[model samples]
Target: MSLNRIASVRAVLGISLTLVLATFFFSPSYSMESRDNSSSPVAGLRVEIKQTSTSPITITSTVVNDNDHTVTFLVYNSPLDTAAPSIGLLTITPDGASEPLDLPKLQIQRQWPPSPESLIQLQPGASQTADIVLKDFIASKIAGKASVALKGRWDMVWNKQKDDVTPEMIEQAQLQAEPDVFSGSFASESVEISPA
Candidate 1:
């Protein structure tokens, strides 16, 4: 590749890395249909959530890749809505409650190569974290309690199954997931975000 091309590639990758870290923080959360898997384990992936603030109710999510191989994730798309996004893809349960709070999900939409731009590849031992601020009704429910338990999940569907696929098409293959990628979910211990 020419020097210019290489530089651009590096720049893009750098931006992507930054975005992945901020995906949770900046990505606008809308009422869309995004799929969430049941609690399962894959390649030693771990997820955790914490309440960063109580004034407006802020929650942060951290995803760590413990596998030796690289894993890519589909950073979700934020719809038009820019209201208070309650939290990440985790289920919220009040302390001493049997079940978690109910929240709406977005529809699953996977474009082609262009879409994979939202995907982030995490190398072994690498982690990405982002936080969301909540001021909606959900925040009101969780306020004045002590702490609320949060559940976190990670799902992966690589873009390549059989070799022979082109270099450019690789990311798309993973983004599509197409039931080919192994999906797993795990719940995390609660963090104190609410105050009495």
Candidate 2:
């Protein structure tokens, strides 16, 4: 090819490559969907518990969603059961140390099904806060540098339908589905617990 023709072809190729790169890097939907598949989806689901009184403890959580899909939250007992008398397990370690904590059985309560009575649909970069009340679940003595570890296995379902799939079918499929048998710690934080 002539020198002018070669220069023209190189310019066109460079422009096309730049456009492709911009599309891939600047697309919000693509980036959000990519994060949805990873643990970033659960990063917003944080829980904080404190002993507000001798008999009652206050728990707060900020559940954020940075995706374009709806998510449902369900709270269940540790070891996760659909049956009644479901209880969650909370552990506390003193002075940022990883050791067994001596604690008694406690009662933790969560608002069933969550409020507003609708599926939580999060637009791009949306978030919300959830408050929980925990009662009869505070240790009698908590002092010095300590780390509180709270863990609960709650069932969650993605509500957004795939292309060409019906919501009715999804519900029916869930009815016949088996529970996932995976469990791990969700969130933990170090705190200074003062003596009351």
Per-residue lDDT tens digits for candidate 1, residues 11-67, read 999999998878765555421213212212253667667766766676676667787
Off by over 4 Å in 1: 1-41, 77-88, 96-98, 104-114, 146-155, 159-180
Residue-level lDDT tens digits of model 2 in 1-196 = 9999999999999999999999998799678656555633344444454444323333344445444554344334421222211243555566656583655554656554334333344444555544334333334334454555456653444433223233454345446742221123455354344333
**lDDT (C-alpha, whole model) for all candidates:** 0.54, 0.46
Tell me, by TM-score, which candidate is best.
1
Q: Which ten residues in a row have the lowest lDDT in candidate 1?
A: 77-86
TM-scores for candidates 1 onward, in order: 0.53, 0.44
Q: Name the lDDT of candidate 1.
A: 0.54
Which segments of model 2 are wrong by more than 4 Å?
Answer: 1-57, 76-86, 96-124, 132-137, 161-175, 178-185, 188-196
Cα misplacement distance, residue 101 of candidate 1 (Å): 3.2
User: In candidate 1, how many clashes are counted?
Assistant: 12
